[model samples]
Target chain A: MRHPSYLLACLYLLSLSACTSVTIDEYQRAEASLASGDRIVLLGRRHSPDYETEPDLINCVGKVISANQSGISVIPEKQFVDELYPWFEPRMAPMRPERLEYLMKQPQVREKIEDLKLRYVIWIDGSTQQTGSAGSVGCAVGPGGGGCFGFGTWDDKSDYEAEVWDYQKQDLVAKVSADAKGTSYMPALVVPIPLLARVQSNACKGLGAQLREIFVPDSSANAGA
Target chain B: MKKQLSRSLLMLSSLILAACSSQLTVKGQFPSPLTTAMPLHGAAYYSPELISHSYAEDDEDRVKWNIQTGAAQQEFFDSLLPALFQQWAGHSPDPEGEAFKLPGVDIIVKPTLSDFQYSLPRETRSKIFEVWIKYNMQLYQNDGQLLADWFITAYGKTPSGFMQSDEAAMNEAIIVALRDLGANLTVNFSRVPELQDWMGKRDSSVQQQSADRGGVQNETP
Candidate 1:
């Protein structure tokens, strides 16, 4: 019965930690669809001075979308930026669909996009930040050995939004956003046991799944056909 | 045997201490800007010192750093100037010689690395390395009249990563700064007041010459 109390406490701690809630909201102005040969490029917005959207998050979403969806190709962000060169650099990239019209007017850029069969440009902006943190863990080492004893906990929030621009139509077709929040903990008696909440990855998967649903509504149906 | 062991320990300590210093050779890939080429022949002149520029700093804590960016700057302009003008030419003087004016060049551009500075993660109490570069750009006409003299400043920063070397982080920061320089120069070149005035006058003069030639042709019949 005494050991059962330890089990109950463990369950309580696990319940308090590692619980991530992800919410996704999508706005579509027009019908958005993707063809088999069409390509999509994911770019992170880096113009903000305070915080930059992490390249890792962009890559994670790209991987998730490509892994789950069929007949969809995702262009690597660096490749796309490098192929277009200075035009797509952080300061020079088009922030709005209207500015993209001017970019398309450039013959080389237009030709490259056409040659690559690029259909959509998804601009992901936002970052994950530590909203709050409390508690601390301490460890000691001596001639005999070393052990850690304490409890530490922190909260993180991630907010990201994706703006999908259609190349042919030269308009913003869809806007999707994801927000996630979670708390992580590390409890130590003799050894520290870490329970990390995957807030950024959860947000990435949520956003990726929503993007896939918009691009491919009936993936199974398409597959059977 | 004790003396030999002490010497070995001394050598190991020196090796560990030497690892704290960093030397970085910055390299970058510059892209041609996306703008219509102006109908002018521009000659770019880079001094030998600019081509071999390096910034070295020794801090109070005995940490030394040297960053070489001269070759990268030269390459950046070599790719940028040709795409900005209809005709492009490059001129470089020998180490001991002075750069002379080109015969048929419409405009000459001289750029110099004025200043370079950086900050380390430990100093800033943050997980990022930052670099700033300042350049002085001088534009002259074929007759040696100064058209525009301006300063362009660029900044770059990279977040420090776990298990990443200081040299790698600094190199990435330099590359970012170089890219930023390209973006600023390409987008803001035509907007310079002196350049705009000179270009407007040059275009009108060319139009006048064409009109005079047409009048002469009309009278010949």
Candidate 2:
């Protein structure tokens, strides 16, 4: 009976732990870039870039790219991979600057890049890793049946950064970053309850919002209050 | 009296655990690959006894069970493999191929369940209920020629805090296994020498048709 309260307290404390977010850095239109307006990178420029209507704009953009169909070129992940085959390797994604620079030199590559009509090459990259976990668990197994007993905690940190490369200028311009930490627990005294980290998803959304800000040009954020 | 009370408590716990056992099933196929229908013959054989019918828990090394869930190896294998095969290979013209004798059956797959278990392993201060399955696949030509025979093992693990139940873990593991199985068949189907020869012998136009289809695979054998 007392154990449940103790576990709840632990969970409460864990949830209270601080969460980090992405910082949308300063960026400018590359000299070679096309002039465009607010549109989510996920949904291409078919719909109008109406930011007020989509309050959940931050949630819409998964990593860095705005998913609005109107402003950003929303190339399907499959199509992007297939069309840019030999170049757009999904396994080896977030192509290195040097590699991208080399590819931009090729006429055919440049033609394809222009063909995609990508104004800003948004590279959203990051991963969540379990940094540390500590605790002990023991289970009792017998003919009657088996159950686990023990308490443990796992530490996980999600670190992600988004980089926007201007293909026209052939230069890296904007960078946004987010980092958050979380903990998971196993309180399997009689019954088990697991509290996994809320790190990666938070980092993704946090970073995504900042990237959207840069693309959407938030007047509220820019205006001096 | 204490012993009696403990027994009663154990019985009550067993009932509750049984109720908590999940009913998991794989629904729908991924997507059909082949344009044409190929008759796949034979049933995937899973010994229910080999894998305990109820939920079993392996604590790192020790294995024990107390709850009996509705999940069965045969039910899972029967429902999943056909649809999986369709997605990976193409189409199974005859999903229900009859016995040892069937007409127009070019390829037959005999799948035997080797090892199936859900375990909770302690790693880096976390308990992961790892569901794993090992199965042997025997690919044979219609003329009873063994084209290829191999074993595949696949697993799915969820941390102690995230996993629903052993049955759920088992279901995920099954899906992973079948996914692997489908990929195995698709990539290796054309590589079977016996199948190639049999198809060529049955119809001389088979090679010509394949050539016309421009079917070139990376792993030809």
Candidate 3:
């Protein structure tokens, strides 16, 4: 013969303890990994840009050319102007036109091209459609195991993608792809916010590792390149 | 009497056991509503370089955009305004319908360029986009009286590296702006009790007027 009050108290405590927690340590690790190098450049595309893979290919090649022991220099093939500042007059007034023109022609701007260096570049392409479900249900299991009931469930999904390009010889060296998915309850006790960050970090990590493998070979010739 | 007391205790125990065995669960349902609002009506105004500090005279000669931080503040706001309007509108009582009646709020957002300096390993140099945007909002009443005036600012940085497409960089800027705006708005709204009350009342009145008209009010003005 067991006491029912004791069992009820135990159940309440157990349910309360089930609350989910988020770990900032995971985010810190991801941030630390990204901050480790200075030469690498991360570029993202809005949707997938359709071009003869040349620009993409060239960017990858640029990465390989820019690769150094310090880190790889990744550059997007296209010059991204700030749409927010379309008209160059006021926003760029402080920047001397001649200076910008000169900088573009600067040896450094053309570093990898002139130096003939090898580097790694990643281009994120395409978005993903994700789906997920979550819920809670209250039920009663009798001595005879007859009474059972269902409570609730939830589902959600978001779309995004990353296309990674590794440049080694002014040619596309390597390409990698990653996707993110998320779902949670109404108030999203555990999933949405924290999970979204995790998804992004994981995707970036995957893309980075994949690009590293493609560009960095174990052979002596390519070991440092 | 003893037997009766024993039976009562047995019943009490049984009731407790039964209650404990059954679980009570509550489920909350929330539609994944689009959190963005229609773009706010505003423009990014650029001014000539307030101060020039670069050593390169050629750098000073570049035809600067209205605002000289690497990215354009106006373009960023254009893409971002609609979404922000939609988000702010969404949080309101009549998100879909009453937003338009409030008339478009006029916001002048300007970005101040600060400290765009970067150094390479052996002293190679690059530029940084250390920019801050100041948002001046004037909320107008139907009668043209300024209902609320607010000033909010946000900061973001673009390190020296491969410059992505203008659109991509702009999108990133917008995202940063939106995040900052959300936080600023949340804090502002929470702290200003009178504004919140006024907004609530105005929305309710708008809803009532629509109901009296026997039709829904169109959100677009």
Candidate 4:
């Protein structure tokens, strides 16, 4: 018979390897495609007092979108924010298409946008949170040795929405939302084994893929403008 | 064996104690604002107190934090002023001086730190370290008449990640707050009512001077 410790290890490892579930929902207004030299920028929403959409997630989506040979170019969030400075700051950033229109009226701003060849601005808003947690892990150190023992588990949920704005057109063209959920486990024998779920990463991939579909449809027949 | 054990225990206790206190210097670089400078010569004065600002907080849990951000604040304004005005000059800090009389200086600006506050993840029951900074900006005419006095507030927060040190998180928060401050100042400089009135007068004076010169030149021609 297998020892209980071995069984626990096997069981926990199996559970930790469980996959995360991600769902993507998209709403497109007609169709849109990127032309040569057209670039896109992904910015995180920070106006919310309680939470901030993490920059890492934005970078992840940007990378995923450009990963495929779709000729989709993405501007780094930091570079874009820096180039635009004060205008895209949390307080002054336009949260709506109408506000963006007003901002584009400024000659300086309009000129800079044109120079950047920026076609789309994707505003990402959302955060990953530990929805629920149970169990506990305790650690103790003594003269002889130190070790941690216990079982802990927590659930994480990531919900994000990306709003695509056609900068030249000064309007919202598409909206893509991603939701991902997973459970993480930590089972400690002599040392704690943390099995973390890629909850936010999964959400990012889903959002990125759906955004790609908007510009580069799955098939040429599916392409629309 | 017993002696070795005692040594180990003492070392462990010392390590735990060391983790309770955090001290860090906030450091960051500010990007030059990408806007057309106003057609005015400006001077900024950074007081000694504002350039040496620091905050310390101690709690019953023996958690001690000391954050130094004065240097960063000085750098932020130093980089921003030059880019925000057509002509910019920084003079020696003088707390008692009422007015500045420098050649071609149209406006004088003084920024002071009013308040600073922070919350740790444990206190807020969240995995985020947050900071808030309040500043009071005073704009003056070359002759010391106060043109505008207003408050600018900025906030920053970073979520705690596994294996991330408190110092790193707090530093990130401060950087974010500083960037926010720059953004607010740049975007809203003319939005202040008093400053708007001053700009209106300044613009009209320039227009009157141009018209007078034009009339003279036209008559001579």
**Candidate number with greatest TM-score:** 4
What is the C-alpha lDDT profile of model 2 across B81-184, one tens digit per residue?
55323323322222234544434555656666666665444322334445556768666555555666777765444333343555454454444344444444
Candidates ranked by lDDT, best first? Answer: 4, 1, 2, 3
- The most accurate candidate by DockQ is 4
The docking quality of candidate 1, as DockQ, is: 0.47
The local lDDT score (0 to 100) that residue B190 gets in candidate 1 is 73
Docking class of 3: incorrect
Q: Chain A alone, TM-score for each of the models?
A: 0.89, 0.63, 0.35, 0.89
Per-model TM-score, in order, reads: 0.82, 0.48, 0.27, 0.86
Q: What order do you get sorting by DockQ, best first? A: 4, 1, 2, 3
Global lDDT of each candidate: 0.84, 0.50, 0.36, 0.85
Q: Give chain B TM-scores in order.
A: 0.86, 0.51, 0.36, 0.84
Candidate 1 CAPRI level: acceptable
Task: Show model 1 residue runs off by greater than 4 Å.
Answer: A1-17, A135-150, A187-193, A218-225, B1-21, B58-64, B94-99, B120-126, B142-145, B210-221
Lowest summed lDDT across 10 adjacent residues in model 2 chain B is found at B28-37
For residues B1-221, write the lDDT of model 3, one tens digit per residue.
99999999999998875553312111111111112232334333233341221222134333222223333333333444344343332111121224334345433333333323222112223222333455554444433344456676654333333455332333344343433443454234334454456667867998998787765345435
- Model 3 chain A scores worst on lDDT over the 10 consecutive residues at A23-32
Over the stretch A1-225, how does candidate 2's per-residue lDDT look in tens digits?
998999897677556543334333434443323366321123111011111111122234543443433244455543444344334432223355456676666455566656777656656554456788898778888998888889988887765556676655556767766777777777776555666666666666666656656655552254323
lDDT value, residue A57 of candidate 4: 95
lDDT of 3 at B137: 46
Candidate 1, B1-221: lDDT as tens digits: 99999999999998987787778888877777767777888888788789999988866674689888899989988988777788887763321234545567787888899999988889886667888999999888776667899999988877776588888889888888888888898778778899999889888999999999999999996
**How close to the true structure is residue A131 of candidate 2, measured as C-alpha lDDT?**
83
lDDT per residue as tens, model 4, B1-221: 99999999999999987788788999987888777788788888888888898887756664788888889989989988777789887763342375545556887888999999988889888888888999999987777677788899999888887788989999988988888888888878857898778889888999999999999999994
